[model samples]
Target chain A: MVDGIVITGAGIVSAIGVGKDETLRSLLARRSGLPGGKVGLSDLQMKTILGIPGEETVARSSLLGILAVKEALQEAGISYTGTAVLVSGTTVGGMDITEEHYLEMLGGEHPELFRFHTCGSSTDRIAAYFGGFGSLTTTSTACSSAANSIIFGANLIRSGRFDVVVAGGSECLTRYHTAGFDSLMILDKEPCRPFDASRAGLNLGEGAGFIVLESSAHASSRGARVLGRLDGWGNACDAFHQTASSPDGEGAFLAMTKALEMAGLRPEDIDYINAHGTGTVNNDESESKAMTRLFGGCVPPVSSTKSFTGHTTSASGGIEAVICLLAMEYGFIPANLGWKEPSEGCIKPESEGRSKVFLQHVLCNSFAFGGNDSSLLISNARDYE
Target chain B: MNRKVYIRAAAQISVQEPLCEDWMLDPKQLSGPFLHCIDPDYRQFFSPMQARRMGLMFKRAMVTSRKVLEASGVECPDAIITGTALGCIENTERFLDPLCRGGEETLSPTAFMQSTHNTVGSMVAIALGCHGYNCTYSQDGVSFESTLLDAVLQLECEGAGNVLAGAHDEITDNVARLMEATEPGGYPFSEGSVAMLLSAGESLPDALCEVSDVRILSRREAVEEAVAGYSAEYVMRNDVTFSLFGRCGSASGLAVYAAAEMIAAGRYSSVLVVNESGSNAGLVFLKKV
Candidate 1:
């Protein structure tokens, strides 16, 4: 197993909470961050309780990314040296502002907001906000973006390209996708209950999650605290449907199998599985099938934390990784929040609130549109030592 | 240094004619601020039904990927990676227009589904039935370079055989106007797709050029500082043999084509392709072995 790359620090801002501590507090308390009622959008008629804080009147994707990066760097206790490469992932990017000024360009108003419309604009903005960096880029693969960012960051370190890299993604709830998903009939009218018999669809949320990844040699030389080891990661394409997973979950199966092969571990070694339970009818069934196919006899305790944060899409992978580290640090498994019954032949998730388990190895899954599927295995640093 | 990566074959579809031959020899000069692709017979790649649903950017990606794979003589790649700056912006705008004016109910799932940044990559994979490692980068000027870095890592460290990597970007009328207003010095926006089939140099005996190194800097000024220490005197001897597109927004993959052309012609044993934006630059070095 490749063991040189480790996560030194992580920061998350979701509907559940702002910082890691607050998010953990809410997770331990079994709190649901989904809005209780319909929250009005600025221009569109749709009303979904997107995880944005009510006080964030000026909530833009780039601003949220900057804020999340600040928290991560602060927790890592590292000053801005402009040495680390920044790899950000996002889907909405600056659409929150771009949508506001779309007509202004046609009217010859030439507003400043149009500059942030590109996918890379958010990453560049974050870099500018944080002075500068050795390099900067963005990975945008729908929902699995940040997960791939972590994978790419680890590969960069392993390839001897750089010693330190900051990798994550930020996405904001935009009317563009909210309306789009509604057209696809995937947004649940009420709060989503993932992996349940009554599972309807997902409730889209917005936030950012970033982790400071450094080589073990680099971290130890600097006396940095080690959070967790990024043991392995895998990505695969379904090639079945554009927005739907295969009935048997071929993509998810290959991704999980590849990740296990990379980490040189069997299915029995995994202590927990953070299922990509999008609460959609197709995703839950397919993911459940994939898990069963891989872990026949001993299926690990699996759950979807999307129940708490309303499926942050691109940021889901990053947020879930941080949650895994918190679980390992505090010695507890996060509750699945909402689940009662399970589909036939599928293992039930840890639906009961706050299961106490000494976790060692955790698997986080993030599946996105166009059948883009990814899995990450983050192990406790102590286990490796 | 780790194992070197090679560019087996590369192809592009730009404002000029879509051919892997000497199209760049005497390129058609742009007459207008908006430079649209010269467009090939896309019907040759996709069926009528499929073509109707796909966007122009998606079509460009499909055609370029096919040409690249044919040139490389590889039918199925181990992995597919892509990068795009303005991914399906036309479709994005199409989906956003009615939603902004006519509310959320008046939307179709087709435009919305095709609007994702990764759609181009995923579509290519789906068509090829490739279920291997798939990823897409969208970092504007460095988007294509990011994919190249991933391809290199796959070949050198991750134990992958052949990888198909490429970039696609299309500027909508609205985005062109925005660029004009925001960055006046920016070139008139253009749209195209560039694809390259990459393999490990040790395994591919028929490779065209070896990719020695790829460097990405956070600022344009750092380009000089990074290259100052390099032994690039060979490059300095070559005059302005190629005319740059003149401040094109970010046709990053075009650099690979230029570097490969120089290596193939035996003009220089090594060529460096550098793409610079205001606050960023992506440098790729190619050597003929």
Candidate 2:
């Protein structure tokens, strides 16, 4: 088992499901959560569980965050310890709610909504909903926001700053981002095919995913069951384009390389890769190039669950991370759905789901706009021991 | 882990004179409920083509970063980290106003592309072609504090020799009015940017000041308890710059800048910077090098 920082629990809420059990079933069944071409979660049913009054308008990001965080805390058996920190990643923030009332806000009405307009508001709302946290920080690095939050939380624990940190991100679809991505001509109206030759673009989704991380000393003292170990993480800037990745995938290559180096693992050791395949032609091709550059023909079973979950934007990193952990804990490989035919020079992903094989190491990638690319290396317990 | 972090250089574009420390000599008294940065001629640093597509917030972040790098002579920092609450607000409004006023018709992608919170920091990396660790924090008052905390860890523990860290936020008319009407009696809603080049103390031959510890806590935390263990010369409970610099999400950078200015001028050997947003509070410790 990993002898250091370990993941005690993880929680997720997406179109696929509200918790890990539901998500696992959907993944193995190859169910597409993109119900009828749109990526929307039913808020009425989710809100009933939130306990907030129906009249009060809570940001969708915060609502999803609370659901995920509550499940994570419950699984981790963590009580209300004020010293536990919360590092949240959310770029949508309250924009999901505020965008509807934008003009009213401009007119100085619905000013209450203004408080949740910033990117940090959702994190604050979640922390407030769950009593309080010792400290809170929010990362807003586009889609990688939540991924970077987990990295920051890991750094906090490694620095001997805190015993535990709740790290992940939550994002909800908004007309703001939908129209923004649409105007950029990157969104595909049809179902997205991540690595196929005809891969067009991504369908945006909304959800939240959170994981409870604790130091080895703390977990052992509390007799916590370690789900997985956060072996390594790396964040790098492409510096190539504001929104486009380099043709060589230099940033993605560097991020993956750094993570592998940190984890002290060779490329061949990784059992699977959760690709940042947003189905955009540029992204799939570039990420393949990065994988080729790093893995050099021996790339592992890589899959992009975005085809199933519909590119959750900021939440994809955390959601896919929990997905990887689930695959490792169980013995299943999530199929890279929507792949028809792979283009030349592009590595062919595992087209079908496989189970009953023990996974040792897994890598998940989340690349964001502005070329903020990040990669995480997760390892199953008992391997190192 | 105990390696001391040092501030090599500090630069700001605020209500005070841009590209200079005129605020220390003759501090500008904010005269309105909203204040804007007295921008310098960006043409000196940015070509017209480079300046054309960027919004004001992007320009301010770039100019301040250029200043920080120029002062420290560090062409490419090991990491570029920043904090911004309302990222690219001007662009956000530019993209939103037309669409919200009408329908989803004729929405431009330029503003939308530059509207992400990480745009400011990532643009710096693109300009310098420095592909290193890059991040953006978007909390409220503690945005800058969060960046500083990351920078400290980078320098001390992560083997990053140097880092460019800062914060930038701009208040638009609608947002300013919203803040004014909602949170009355608060500092004048303002716009500003501050960048600091930081390195470990032992690695740098000379530093402007030293940053030792940064602690973030809930807003419910008492100032005394937050600073109970640390001994500092200037223990700022609430940051001392809002009245002068006005209130911005990244205003805490102004506090750190002000603290560094004081340390440089031999006014204080050590200083504490505290910033409390609505939800959480951040405390930073700075000492004279």
Candidate 3:
């Protein structure tokens, strides 16, 4: 009924790599981008931290995002000439810089640090960098940021507002995020083991991912290679807690259920699920309960890619979506690293380097801090053929 | 598949004192470069310990959401959706202050944890324990309208009976100073939160208005597209009386303001309000039953 919004191209820049191919290769090999110590921190308190490493070429999030979008546009074979860009999703957005400048200003009278207040201004910079100026938008919905961006982009296409749209999210490592997670007592010093009985908390990661989506007609006319079809998406709020998923994952359940319903499919029609396994005790358990309620005993092969890339926060869904497409394209399933010994009443994710049956339909879940939950359904483009 | 959704109850906290009954429709001019909400005593609504951790933006959002819920007489809503151009700016500023000033040592955790843009909506959920569908949208000017659109989608596609949808934007010294330095020609700095209780059916007698449709468009084509897509003649025939325009952010709210003005002048029977600030734009049509 939607005439199908096709994902013609996708790109990703994570702690692992700066392009889709590099990221996938790293994920397939079970490589970790998490360093033993933090980068760019000079003080002793900053030691013993792990994150993605980069320099002043761009803000960490923006750099990763730009790398991803570059690859995505190339893969789509579209030149960035006056295209519409919509960058939706959440992040501290220049808070990394803002925090640094606030200190510098307090210590002395450094006037150069005032540029970070233009947090959302980075979207414009990205768009301009890509030679795009049609319409630019940014959405900040916590973890579900990029997923919501994708949904809004698709809606714009369906509404006949744009010919081509670039949508996704990005987040970068920051001391502020680390301190926040630490405050909640949810920062795991060890590599996060999602859904593990002994699971403790999430290990923060940073990256960006994006997809070039176009109307099916537009894609076909340009002879662009369609990676997959964005069948449907749904978003819901679990009006439950500030930082915790509901006991039953009501919001997650509704988002997934509604997405499938909109796609005109059922649970049996799904082949795999990319879970929002943040390795946190609360998230894994609640998401598992929600999956159980929705799929009953017939839950499909499920895994959380967060183990490989760390929790990318806003970019989690976008990166996961790219992984789903790659799985469908290559006929393989990436492993969920650090997952072992499933928790009580939870399904165990496929171990590292375990290949699954040929995937046809994949569901990706992205849940954020505000109880904002979003689910996206991606299926092989050949399915409709 | 287009369906009608009505705004049964509404609450707003703004510089004009829109929340209190005594301040109805009495517009106030903002004197300073920055205009903050005449905030109600949030202490009465939230516990100090809980409030101790929340930023001013989240506190305002919680208070406004509670006011809307109480006015609507709904113990729990089916969903909670919020939109904010700058989410938890105060918290972000607070979290960064110590790290920058104290050389990244002895930093506080509370500010960092609550600094994310969705904190307001998340805190609202924690306060209510509703366990329903809750999401936050942070798309610049159209943040609130995007939230409203999602609420409508819930009603039409997901069978949501009642939903709480709202938008809140707060002004912080950091944000105000930055805006002043960067974009000197932008609208005066303002902070406010508005919430509405939306129901599927005509369950309330005093339902303020019904939302007919909502739209988001590019600034370049907004006027032409709005005029073409939404005909003044059609609106006139449908008994639309006025429109509320959000002229602050590139006049993205102009469409609604024009519609509200028309309705207020008795030129039409219904009205529309539109707002666009930050990075997004939205239009909402209201029909008087």
Candidate 4:
């Protein structure tokens, strides 16, 4: 692991909690932070709303992202002098403000608000706080964006370009996207139930997650404690439809297979699978088929933490990657909440949170519209043992 | 890092022309408040149903990418990467214009699905049945540079033989007016798509140019200091592109397209394409093969 793309530090803000300790506490308690799941719709939003006290004007996405990035850099002991490149993923930049004020702007009231609508604006805003990064970019492949950012950051290091990279994504909820999913008839009235036969759809949520990725040499030289290694990543286009996953999950199978191949690990090496299960009929079925295909019908412990945080959409990939690290760190498998029953062939997720099972390698899946599907494999620090 | 990456082929649909390098000889002199990319006849590429369902941006991405792959003699690229500032603004408008007027129940699934930034990239992959590395970057003006950098990494580090990279954007009448009212540059908002097939190791006989390197920098001062080192024979700045094809996020990508055309025609031995958004800059180095 010391010669791999090791993650030195990770931070996240989700509906469940603001940081690692609180998130792990909530997960161990099997508490669902989603709005529709045993809570009011708008009452249980983000875990902590950032007023940041003395911060200037910035989008909520950037605000959340800044908080996450600060915690991550602090943990990694990264400062402005480290010359770390930042690769952030975000789909809705300032849409939360734009959608709310578009009509008024048409009448020439605060037209400057339109400037913040670009997805890159949020990345730039986040970078501005670090006094400027060595380099920065934004990825926006829908829901799988954050996963792709991590993949791209790993590539940058593997290519011998940068020593340290800050990779993750942030997203804020907006009425426009919520209604968009609702228009597709995919928003569940109740909490979502992934891999369950009676599942309806996903509930929308918002948050940000970030991880400090450093070349193993860079991390060791800086004396930063390596949490885990981002062993493998694969991104493939389903190419089946704009929004719907193929019935056979062709893209998902290919992605998982590629990740396994890249990691030089067999399918059986994976201790757990963090599924993309959006609680929709299409996703759970397709993901199950992919898992069955790749694992040869003997799938590992499977669950979707989206069951807790709802579908953070673009941010889910990064958030869940952090969740995977937490699971490996805490030696537990979080329960796939909201499941009542399963179909005949679908993999049944763990019903209750389990403790004392140290995960060696875990796979995380994130699928998005336009057939963008990505998978990442993270291995614990047992590599040098 | 020692691998030689070549621009095997390039195609673009813009104000000057569509899928042709004829603009190198007789460039179009066009001025616009909102310059829409000219679309060629789609009867040859897509079916009636597809043409009806897809918006202008999708068709542009498909046509340009298809044209690039064909010109490069690549049946299917190992990866398809694209960049766009606004995903599908037309479809987004289609979904939102009515929603603003009628609160709920008037949602268009088609519009909503195609409104994402990756839809164009996804459609291109579907057209080619390419299941390889797929990505989309939306980092404002440097979106396309981000894509080209990824393509470079895929070829050099990931052992990919060929990569199809492109940048696309479409300006709507509404967004054009908004830019005119807000943005200080009277450069006129515009739209276009530029796609190139990049290959590693050996160069093809008819390759357009060699891509030595590409970079995207956050600070303006760093770019200014770095430009002195390359000493390219010719440089195409943001102002030049702004005047040529109006303004769009992918205009920097268009500069890459234009540089390739110039190098292929022997106009310049080396060209450095530079574009900046505020202090951020994207640089693409191209040279005659």
Chain B TM-scores, listed for every candidate in order, come to 0.91, 0.95, 0.82, 0.96
Candidate 1: stretches off by over 4 Å: A1-3, A36-59, B203-205, B233-250
Q: Report i-RMS for every model.
A: 1.7, 2.2, 3.5, 2.0
Arrange candidates, best lDDT first: 2, 4, 1, 3
Q: What DockQ, on C-alphas, does every prediction get?
A: 0.69, 0.69, 0.35, 0.67
Candidate 3, B-chain TM = 0.82
Predicted candidate 3 versus true structure: per-residue lDDT over A1-385, tens digit per residue: 2377899999887767667787778777888765321222232211122122333323545555666777888899988546565655657666566666665454444434544433355565466456555666667777888897887777767756567888888777777777778778887888888888888888888777899989899999989999998988877777676677888998899889988987999999998899998888999989999899999999987888787778888888888899889888877777777777868967788766456457778899999877888999998877633
The TM-score that candidate 2 achieves is 0.97
lDDT of each: 0.79, 0.86, 0.70, 0.85
Model 2 per-residue lDDT tens digits across residues A1-385: 2246899989998888889999999999998886232334556656787878777778888889999999899999998848898988988898867778888888768776788788887888899888888888899999998899998888888888888999999988888998999999999888888888988889888888899999988999999999999989889999999999899999999999989998899999999999999889899889999999999979899889988889888888889989998999888899988888977656798879688878999999999998999999999975743
Q: Which candidate, 3 or 4, would have the higher lDDT against the true structure?
A: 4
TM-score evaluated only on chain B, model 4: 0.96
Instruction: Give the number of the best model, judged by TM-score.
Output: 2
**Tens-place lDDT digits, model 3, residues B146-170:** 6777677667645788898877777
Off by over 4 Å in 3: A35-58, A80-85, A104-115, A158-164, A340-342, A383-385, B1-9, B20-26, B41-56, B66-79, B103-106, B126-133, B148-163, B185-188, B197-289
Query: What is candidate 1's CA lDDT for residue B168?
Result: 86
Model 2 lDDT tens row, B135-180: 9999888888889988877775567988999899998888888777
Report the C-alpha displacement of residue B119, candidate 4, in angstroms: 0.4
